[model samples]
Target: MTFETDHLGFLLNPLDWQPAWAEQSAEQLDIALEAQDLAIIESLRNFYFEFDLSPPMRPLVKHIKNNFGADIGNSIWLMQRYGESPARTLALLSGLPKPKNCL
Candidate 1:
C-alpha cells in the first residue's frame, strides 16, 4: 500500500495511520515490528494526540519509562530496537510528524 508520507517518510496525515501501514513501514526500515514495538507505536500515537506533536528523544524515553518501565525505556534499548535515532524512527513508524528537533 502506498501512503502519503513526508520527505522523511512520516505519514503526511496522522489519521491515515493503520497497523498494517506501521508493519510496512517497519519492514522498509529493516526493523521487524514485534508486539513490543507495536505497543511503543501506539504510545507514540497517543502522545501525539495528547501533545499535538511528536516528541524528541528525551521526552520520548521519559514517556516510555513512565508507561512501560525502565528496562524498555532507556536509550540503549530504544537504540537497539530502532537504531541510532529512536525518536525519528518511532515517529515515522507511528505515522506521526517528525519531532521538530529530530534533525
Candidate 2:
C-alpha cells in the first residue's frame, strides 16, 4: 500500500497520529512515557530526518545517547520503558516507518 512520506521520506499515517499519540500509544501498551520518553521519540524523528531511515536498536540508542545523552539513551533502559521492542514502539508512536530489523 502507498503511504505518505514524512519530511524524512519515512512512510507515515498522519491521520492516526498526533502529538498526543505518543503518550496515547504508551498508555495502550500499559506503560507511561514521561517527558524523557517523548524527547527520545522526537530524537528518533530527527534521526530519520537526517539519515532518511528509522533506526534499529543499536543506532537508536547511539543517536539518543549522542543527542540527548546517556540519561535517556541506554538500550536496556529504553526496552524497560517501551518494552522488549523499543524500536517498534518508538516508530509507532512517532508515526514513522517501522525501523529496519524491528520485526
Candidate 3:
C-alpha cells in the first residue's frame, strides 16, 4: 500500500504494519534511525509475536540485550531516539499496542 506522511511526518499504516513499516514510523517520529534501530523493531515484532504483548521500557531493553546483544540494546541509547517514553513510541512505530500500563 502507498503510505503518506501524517502531520507528525511519519508514515503510518497501522492496520498493515510489517517490520518494513518501522522506517516510515521512525520518520514520523522525526528521527533518523541507524541499522540498530531497525533491528530493534524486528526484535520487538518477534517479542510481540511470541508473547502477544508489547514490552515496557526495562523489559524491552532487557529483551534487546538478551536477544540482539549489547551493541544495540542500551536503554539510554533507545531513550535518545524517542525521548523518555521509548515503549510508547516503539509500540506506535511498530504498530503494536502501547505496552500494558504505559502512560
| Top-lDDT structure, candidate number | 1
Please list all clashing residue pairs in model 3, or write none if there are none: 9-28, 10-28
Give each model's whole-structure lDDT: 0.91, 0.74, 0.73
Report the lDDT tens digits of candidate 3 across residue range 1-103. 4555455433344456765567666676787877777767777877888898789988888898898787657877778767888988887777777677777
The clash numbers for all candidates, in the given order, read 0, 0, 2
TM-score of 1: 0.96
Residue 54 of model 1 has an lDDT of: 94
Q: Is candidate 1 or candidate 2 better by TM-score?
A: 1
Candidate 3 local Cα displacement, residue 91, angstroms: 1.3
TM-score of each: 0.96, 0.77, 0.74
Give stretches of model 1 more than 4 Å off.
Answer: none
Candidate 1 local lDDT, 1-103, one digit each (tens): 7899877777999999999889998888899788988989998899999989799999999999999999999999999889999999999999999898788
Alpha-carbon shift of residue 87 in model 1 (angstroms): 0.2
Error of 2 at 73 (Å): 1.8
lDDT of 2 at 101: 75
Superposed model 3: Cα runs more than 4 Å off: 1-15
Lowest summed-lDDT stretch of 10 residues in model 3?
A: 5-14
Q: Candidate 2, which segments miss by more than 4 Å at Cα?
A: 1-11, 14-16
